[model samples]
Target chain A: MEQRRKERIDRGVKVRSDSIYALMSWRELSYLTVPRLLLIIGMLILPLVVTSMYWQRVISIVCIYALLALSFDFLAHYTGLVSLGGAFFIGVGGYLTAIFNTTFGLPPLVSIPLATVFGAIICTVLLLPCLPLRGVYFAIVTLMYPLVFARIIEAMDILGGTDGIMGIDSFSNRWIEQYLVIIVVLLLLFGLRRLVNLDLGLIFRAVKDNDQAVRASGMSITNYKALAVLIASGMGCLGGACIVHIYMWTGLSLFALDFSILPIAATVIGGAGTLVGPVLGCLILVPISELLREFGTLRIVFYSIILVGFIVFRSEGIMVYGQRKYHQFERWIKV
Target chain B: MNKEPILQVRDVTKAFGGILALNRVSFDLYEGDILGIIGPNGSGKTTLVNSITGFIKLTSGKVMFRGKDITGRPAHKIADMGITRTFQIMRPYYSMLAYKNLVIPLFSPRAKRTGGWRGGGKLGDRDTVSIDILEEIGFERDSYVPYKLASTLPTGYLKRLELARCLALKPEMILCDEVFSGLSMSEIASMIPLIERLQMSGITLIMIEHRLRELFKVANRVMVLNFGEKLIEGLPEEVIADARVKEAYFGSEEAKEVMDHA
Candidate 1:
């Protein structure tokens, strides 16, 4: 009797280029850099290639969602914190930036950075008490924040109230608006990629694995959790700040659950921990969402079907699957 | 044998609601002896370890290490004081490489302060030190076993990795919770020498095991617990010969049959 099995092994180029010193030839170097270059080049030319003004706006939206997705993935995968406060971060940054630009008379450039920093600090401080909670408890607390903030704004009739803040300044020009977000997305995507590989990143992952074991190693889990939340919230707030300027309006819609949810969906579709996967997921998903707008209310049905199909078939995500294919080759062998 | 006890437990008790998981358990462990705790399932063996290591708060009791009262301290603080423990159901960082698993503890403040295993007054490169510790505990340094993910390692290696992690902390007293469970007979045979070597290195051990034959080979002292109460404590042979232990382990009818045959 003969038996056969399929085996997966790393490609010769992947193996040779595993270390920096072995990347002597251009082939191996390209094998390592080509995927990254494709992402960078592809993103850089997106505005030029889209041509449609409406679709160019969608690209900016994609970048905003990409930032949120990056935050969601980092907290969930690296720190074991499942945050559903994307809307909360967005609303805080959006409102703060709007107030700065409209009432405080600051420009978009000055206000966005200020709002991002201050918004993140506020989110982190509010979330500090919940840092000790893990899993669903932590998630539930985060989910409540946006809902609460939305209602408070509606009731108080402050920060533009129900009508929201209108007359907010747009970027100096269209190109600046598009490129600013795209570049920040690229920077954060790579910066986070580097962060998760550092010694601090090792500690963050250890906290995710087993907090008790991490505690047994004599490090404070709460401090690590708080730090992770601060970083994630900063990214989310930056997205919020950008989206406000793009719309030239800040209102209850800034705290919409869509902001919270779409990024999570994008993360699932892209891949959880790869850092770049969520951005790629945003690239794929945000455009599909726009294209489906023609179907009106029925868009949700098609959108859900696509999500379910991805979940059932390629749940490890596009980036994970693609990376596996890029690095390894499979063949049938007889035993 | 006359050395002062390094760890002292006096009336350590834990209560979960109305049930008494551990009821006033007390024992003294000397500096360099291997003490074996044996019991039927659900007899508070793990609870005892948890209570001592500060994983769970004690309802009422005292734990003294070197004459310092350490009752109800946090798990990490207890571990930093050189009392590390391995879980019953192996909880290695599954996402990390086997050697990288050791690297985490090697980066601990305690590891840095104690200079790690044979660290000789300075904790040098953690990655290299991690591989060295893995090699000492049977992870082949030259092979991919050390480089393989913790999730991919077999139970035998995972168990060794558990011990390897504790060693990376340079622990003084290690409470092992069923390290031999789920291991093959050959694996257990290989593990006996490693346990012996660990004991030879002057680290005290308290092993919780169900494999009585293998456990009796190494343990100088044995304690039996039945239904959260200590049945008896003595030399392994004496504890094995006791009527109460036999009755608790095998039931009265089986005990009679075995005793008559004996």
Candidate 2:
């Protein structure tokens, strides 16, 4: 009887798994259909249409900012941990790469990844102590990271004190830098989606939904939360490394609350947990923010209003709302 | 049919600061038997389940599972060792669909690591088991609507979803805390057949419920508790006839009427 029970259970698991695989295969095939293929092909060739250097510069800045927002969304939506120190890892990456390129005589290529890794490791370890905390307590503790980092950098003579690290080398070719930024943004988009779709990602979501349920299933809640923070910091650090290379300097100004809030705002505005939310948020907010930069002192105010508007109206953000709208349109067309 | 007990609890006690939740509780679960525990509100039935599942630290005594002392093993680790449980308040992931809730257990680290997937005979192929269990519980195989979002589900569906997820683990023993509470008569009746099927599948179950009629019908043996101590453990008919059991039930006039009718 026991043997028969085991055999029946095994067969049940196999059939369900086969069905899930079939669903994924169907999704993949549909994604590659004629109109979808054309749309994807058009998107891939968009940059070639623009000949102006001015457009290139604007696009690069937008990509970098979007990267920052995407990382924040990964933490907030995927793991259900609201961390306010979004810029801390970015600041570390930028500052470290700048310092390495200028003082240590390193190429931008070598310095960027190294700086990102260094920043990621530091933040990952530092965030470990706060893993046991939850809710606003976790958020408040992490919020102090950027503030404390800024104070320490300012007080230290080696980091040029309050003046910050500066005069780092820009990319040798401007076009190369622009393409590099776009590529990084695309990679982050792909990576974020892949992470959310993985078994580990599902575990993180399970933790978010019900920590006690996750624990009873024989998984460590603390470990999973810590891992989420680590991955978020890693993405932030990578974006920061690229931004430093594009702008050629890093300062305490880059690590401010505005930088931190930008990602949170973008993530919220775009849609928190959905695959395309942060990227869409960045696509919309980054261009507007870049345009409003001409307004000087009023730029932050304008961004804040936009963010508040997003929060007040579409609380789930752009992607979620857009997805529903898209579905409605499809249904209407079908009818 | 006599066999050695698979689980033995010796003088187990738990206290929250100064208040005693369980006092010198001792019981045994047989290798392959359905045990029913019935009690009034706050009689420490759930507390006993919690202690066995390692959700709470015991103030005194030890619990041995499969002859190995497993006192204070932590909830997840205890679950890892082939003992799974459900809450009095159901805990299905609200954002996930009904089927996806079952997937969590099927992919549970303990279940997966124990050879539940390839059937190295470690955890014992939980994924395939879960799908079959879902079918047995009367969940439609082709219907994807039920797997959409748990938060949108009716109360009856939620209870079944919780049970389906627990069954996904293919546990050696299942500790169900008040599985029938808050469920409608129809809902309770539907679950009876599923419970019967699970028994037929050779899974040992320990259910705590307030529904005495269902308990009496389903359980081969019944245990009653009052004020954190075991009042009686015997065949349901014998326990119902006990004077102590009737006295405990007499605390409520409605229960007295029900007892007289019985």
Candidate 3:
């Protein structure tokens, strides 16, 4: 009996030790999945493998937009709130970065984070009041923020108004621009993923399931929801700042409804809840949109059809569906 | 007999707009005692539980837990103060599996509902406590798999899972809201032993149950509510025998039928 009890105690200690190892391994796996790091390595190496600047630019823009869509996904999927003002933050980050960089002579590195901070502050102010409402009310309230943002930017001549921000400095080398944009994208992707897997993410999901339940658990649901929106908006703003760095222009057109709606639509199409889903959706859809530019008016029509197709057939979005399919495949392989 | 009560309610009242959900009511939850609360559909049993658990703001009166005034503290805060509750609706995280659903509350700082081994997802300090509780509650390591998808479980397992989730929070007291309302006879039978064991372990419990036989067998004291008012508070035998309690619950012959069935 003594020997058995001793063995039991030993087993218990081993079990706990094993779990600690598992938890650490899970965290390490998450860091490796960073999108920007993967993108950087891919961009640096792909030049040697493929040697096309146009494709590189195309991939770069696709990735930059992917970060924005991923941010929107974090809000819509994780928190269960939809916002149409993603572009509002994106525009805010880009224009502020432009003003700081061109007008005030701030370095790109400092100015970009500062621009995102400004966007986050603005988003928090907007998100706080809108939190009390649910469902379509939230959608309508958030939709208005972008419309108002565009009109405000258009009215301000210092922001370059309808013509947008031009004479923005680009990096001396295209390679630096490519690498910098890739780095930021990867950082936001991995950083946000880590944040989501933390305590805040669980609380956020708790709020998503039942606000009353989270309250019952002794947590304030509203605080976490607002935090999620602010974080997502901040990331969206950062993505916007990156966009301006590459394109070298901040315009009223940058904050258009398409900018707001497309990211959300792409997030939904990519798989709204999972981290990789929106990124993959961005990769797939942005290229399609660019390719359809030759179709002019017909591009919008085609986009609508694609949106409808995803809604009808792949309701969880392409990335989620693909993820589930892959998981199922893995399960089969194991069997 | 002279020991200070762990929980004290002094003429507490709650209103949903113009509707009086709970009238001026008073009760005590003594340390290490199982208190049974029973009422009809509109008898304000859930309302009383909600008010105590901080789901609904009380219109009037005061609730003191551990000699501290906890009148308007939020549900999570109240839970953190060694008070946890399970829902009549039993809101399980549907997207997550049973183990993951259980782990949510286990890993969460506010996991105070039921005790059981909350297996590996993310184990914090609270989760370590949850694991200990899970083991105490007779949840095997294999049972952790059920948490993978909580919504798919049989009703019996769901109740067990919720009970485990609550216990993981390490509450000094638990308020169970209709825990056995919708369960097979075997399920309820399985649950009674768990509750009995918790009571043995010296955890104070306030159970609002319609299952009179189980409530009578388990509760140290019984409190009956009628139309938002406390009709009687007494020992189980006395409360069960009381004519007023019978009238409030089942109107003579109907109550006799209930008694005969039990």
lDDT of 2 by residue, B8-104 (tens): 8898898888878788888888866789998778888999999998988899999999899999988888888878788888888898766666666
lDDT by residue (A182-288, candidate 3, tens digit) is 66666777787888777567667766776676665555677788888888888878878878877888888777777777777778788878777777777778889
For every model in order, what is the iRMS?
1.4, 1.4, 2.3
lDDT of each: 0.91, 0.76, 0.75
DockQ, every prediction: 0.51, 0.45, 0.34
Give residue B72's error in model 1 in angstroms.
2.7
Note the B-chain TM-score for every model: 0.95, 0.90, 0.89
TM-score of chain A of each: 0.98, 0.82, 0.81
Candidate 2, B245: how far from true, in Å? 3.1
Residue-level lDDT of model 3, residues B95-142, one tens digit each, is: 654555545565445443333233243444644454455555555655
List clashing residue pairs in candidate 2: A9-B128, A9-B129, A12-B128, A13-B127, A13-B128, B114-B123, B116-B125
* Residue lDDT tens for model 1, B77-189: 89989999998988888999888888788878899998888787589888999999988999888999999988999999999988988898998998999999999999999
DockQ of 2: 0.45
Model 1, runs deviating above 4 Å: A1-9, A48-53, A99-107, A129-137, A166-170, A329-335, B1-4, B235-243, B250-262
TM-scores of the candidates in the order shown: 0.90, 0.84, 0.84
